[model samples]
Target: MSGVNEDYNAISSVYSQISKLPLMVLERQLVAHALSSCKGQTILDLGGGNGIHARKALELGASSVDVVDISSGMLKDGKTITAASGVNPAMIRWFEGDISSTLAHLPLHKSYDVILVGWTFDHAETEDQLLGMWRNVTTYAATGAKLINTRLAYIPKAEETDGIEKYGFLYPDYKEIPGGISYTYEAFTDPPLRCPATSLTNTLDFDESKSIARQHGFRDYQVVDSEQMDVVKEDPAFWRRFVDQP
Candidate 1:
């Protein structure tokens, strides 16, 4: 399987486990709060793995959500979970493709009121690629729309051991590439698979990300760190450990 596919496949299988962690739960809460403020009826979940955020949007009264991801396995798992949870499956539209291409061709009655690019834009390998992603998002965003993105601020220089113990995954290899950092992990699969998780936006800091958003015509961009969120601030040690890799 391709790198992204394999990693996400393994991730989907353990989605339930990892998502229970305080860090992950806090992330979701923060995102949900952001969605609630948007008052958006239509939402676009870019790189939405297993409809996690999509379901939240629905719970917050979003009429419909379109989930676009590169991993079909993740989407399948998400569909099953959401259906089981009693969310109308029809309310969530799943698309399996790259975000850049998928958004360009997605057929919708109107532009999306809220666009959630959660923890996905860091995959872009270059400034141009990151800008392209914002442009693609802009193509589908309604006027006076809001775009919220969450990304890792810094890549650790060393391998992490605690992630495997806590989340059942370990990034054992770290390499500094041209644009960002590359991490290699051996995900705990039914039959284990080697997965390389790379972040191409390693060079993009908070200011740069906001600048890119502005260049693409998105205004009032705000960058919020997890530490600043009420849910995460309560447990400084956990978040500090999470951000500080081994």
Candidate 2:
């Protein structure tokens, strides 16, 4: 199996559970608020793990939802949960691949009215990759479509161990990088082994992300805090907004 698949499989079972934590729940709420005013029928959930947001989108009156995730394991788990929740299996279409490549090959007839990139773009390891993601998402968006992307902002002097234990993970100070964040946890193990996960934050701050969106033919952009559901930044989570230009 590929390394990415291995990593995702390791955490697939617990992914949904962890996602329901207060912070994550707030993140989803913020995403829903961003789309509350959107009366569109087609929605794309990029890197949408376990279909949490996808299910919510359907409840919000979306007629069709497509979920693209890099992990088949995650998608499988999502299918089971969404099915049990009484969501119609036919309303969602699942695609397994990297977000950038998947977006490139989306059916010509497919154009999203709303695109939700929730807490996943931060995995892009390079500036070029991030820019490519912006471009591809814009390419698949219909004119006047709303794109909402949530990213983790760097918090100065942030706690090295806040809320980690509640999710059954560890955040060791020794593992900290100067300008990035790290998370380590063991998935589905008796003696739970630690898996090292880290991402660099220097390349995709809010300003840089907004700039890229504008360059890719998006306009009327704004930022909102998921917790407050407003323009103020009272929390570490925020979502960027863009409307594709005609």
Candidate 3:
């Protein structure tokens, strides 16, 4: 596999593991809360890694969810998790490959009532890349449809030492797991910060990200909710770490 595909494949398993984490539980709740009024609406789970978000949407009674992912490995893992969770297979439609390419190759007949850019936008290499994806989204989304997404703040240039300082935040240090193979993050504030390029893949200021969205015609985004969950808030470094990574 190439770098992009390999990165996704390596994390595909981790993506599945994330669903079991307390942070993921909060993320699910946040999305579900935003989607409470979408019971009968069709949803598009863009970059639906491992289908965890898609499964939750199904549980919330979405009429249907179309899951699009760039990596086939991730989609394959999603199928596994969905099956293990006993989600109704019929509720999900999986599209494998890049979003625009997939759309061009196999077009969806109808617009989505709700489109989820679930941890998706932060990966764009440039503003144009991100905007292009946004244009595609607006093209296929129904009028008044909601697009839920998340991303990290941009990293500052100089005026700082090496490491996470450039990113304006730190990475929460993780304790070695009992087995000593992988690590589990510890609860702490003011831990070590992370690298932005390594974190979000794409770089953009929070204001810049919002500006791009508005430019693409998405309006009425009031950030209805913005509370850090216990696990994330208690450890101030959590969002600066795991979340901003992917």
Q: Each candidate's lDDT (Cα)?
A: 0.70, 0.65, 0.60
RMSD for all candidates, in order, please: 3.5, 6.6, 8.7
Instruction: Tell me, by TM-score, which candidate is best.
Output: 1
What shift in Å separates residue 207 of candidate 3 from its native position after superposition? 2.6
Residues 1-246, model 3: lDDT tens digits:
124455676556555554544545556767777777888889888777678778888888888888888778899998877778878988898887565333666556478888888756644544455556676688778988888875444332334224443223322332222211111122122332121122222323455556666776776664534354454566656456445542
Candidates in descending lDDT order = 1, 2, 3
Worst 10 residues of 2 by lDDT: 237-246
lDDT against true structure, model 3 = 0.60
- Best-fitting candidate, measured by lDDT? 1
RMSD of 1: 3.5
lDDT, candidate 2, 47-84, per-residue tens: 78788888888888888888888888989998999889
User: Which runs in model 2 stand beyond 4 Å of their true positions?
Assistant: 102-109, 155-204, 226-246
Off-target runs (Cα >4 Å) in candidate 3 are 100-102, 154-204, 228-246
Error of 2 at 239 (Å): 17
Q: Per-residue CA lDDT of candidate 1, range 132-203, in tens?
A: 667668887889888877765655545435433343445557887787777765445445545565666532
Q: TM-score per candidate, in order?
A: 0.82, 0.76, 0.71
TM-score of 1: 0.82
Worst lDDT run of 10 residues, candidate 1, spans 159-168
